[model samples]
Target: MAYTAPLLNKPAEGWKHDLPGPNQPPTRTPNTRLLPNPPNYVDDIYLELPRSTLAIRSVGIWAAVIFFLTSTVAPVLLIDFTVTEGHLPPFVLNFFGLVLLSTFLWIGVYLWRMDTEAPRDEPIRFNRLRRKVYVYRFFHDGAKPFSRTAWGVRPVAYDWDDLHAEACSLYGPMGTGGFIETVTLAVLKPGTHEVIDRFLFTHEIHRGEMYWAMAQLFMQQGPHALPTFPYVPRDWNNEDVSFNLARRLAPKVVWPAEMDLESRTAP
Candidate 1:
């Protein structure tokens, strides 16, 4: 018969009520939960000190000195013994033994230096001027019963931008003799930082993971391209998932994004 328009019902009382005046700030519910700050690469990340107590540089210098003196002077000194006795004396043989012993000692010192000097529970200070990372370590002196040694490493620095990712790992079973745990920040090139690779064995399992996670959160520009975990697909739309994963990975680390907007915008 006749076409008719349906009538619209009015909204309920509280639903349509006027919001408090524009001048009034919105109510703030107390945030009882403490949230962690995001990771920031520009900011320093503190690594804990390891248990070992060896000075890599000091031991290295001593090793070199021992090697040089024995190799260069031992032969010259032995010439006297050869001329007088028509053969090297017992003392001369002992000296030669010392030279061989010193050579191997140097090698042992070099390896021990790396094992003991890995960074732990300390702030790894990055020097932009020298393009190096310096860390202090403590080493024990067996010869001197109650003495400990301190040393530093001169790792070549790659630009924070060059870091692709990082990883952390433990090499051996718990409670067993193992190298210091390490975190390697993966760079695009090999020779970018020769000093670091030459001295310290940067490649380790858990430490690399930690470095990769922190670097991604701190150093990476723009949006993250890859998912933190394998099962998760890479999707920009899933920021919550990405953010949550990063947070879980490094609770103490802070990201630039997490800084107050005011601080980020400041001149």
Candidate 2:
């Protein structure tokens, strides 16, 4: 399916909010939902989550199952014919065996299939000390990737300020229905705003929290910080009610309407 990038407007021209009360001490610290020391590594994590794999893939899992099961029909028919006919030749039986072997082998190929969901130690590591992002892969669960010859993906270290973090939706095949949202953290060339490398990529539902956490990281530690959440807003953003604790947990940082505070500003 076709999709355009979520338009990110840098602090809109002539738009601003009343500076958050300094005495108010931010109401509360920004809570970034992160998986603490998942399985193996110990670094300040920016974002981490399970992505769909062959075993867990909604499409691939079904596809492999469907393809593998369909192959069984041919062998089953051949076996039935040989048993029922009684006078079947030896070559016919051999061919049946071959078909059965091939079917079993095909299914075996996907048995170990899994997505990039690695353990805590072999996870996507973002070191605050080194200013780098490292994606570690492993064949064995408990081993550290430093000495072992494990698969490490292209993880770029950025200056942080140049990293553009956003929550964007990826449209599938257009005909397949809705979009899948992802947490995209990439480095952009200054001025022209060309994307360098999408250093961090996570496809999941909690993209807002990830995006906010990432933004908070860069803003406070990397280059700048903004007290806002990335968009488009979720199911929680529509409510205008004043009573619910869920809504009141955090101040509305996603006000597309309130951002334009020109009229509300002191004239």
Q: Which candidate is the best by lDDT?
A: 2
Worst ten in a row by lDDT for model 1: 13-22
- The list of candidate 2 runs beyond 4 A from truth reads 1-29, 32-70, 79-111, 115-122, 128-130, 137-159, 171-179, 187-192, 205-215, 218-267
lDDT of 1 by residue, 1-267 (tens): 111321112211112111111122222221212111122123232211121122222344445446555564555656776798797668758667677766655555554443434332222323232233333322333343222343343223344333322222344543666644443333334334222221121334333333334323322322242123223222222224342332222112122342222123312
lDDT of 1 at 132: 32
lDDT by residue (tens digit), candidate 2, 1-267: 111433234421121111121112222244333321121212233332222111122333345556667667766776687788885547866687677767654553343222222221223434343444334322422233222344322222355445544544556554568775555454557554566555324454253333335434442453234223332222322455364332333222221233223211222
TM-score of each: 0.29, 0.40
- By summed lDDT, the worst window of 10 consecutive residues in model 2 runs over 15-24
Give model 2's TM-score versus the native structure.
0.40
Best by TM-score: 2
Residue 262, candidate 2: alpha-carbon lDDT? 21
Question: Candidate 1, TM-score vs. the true structure?
Answer: 0.29
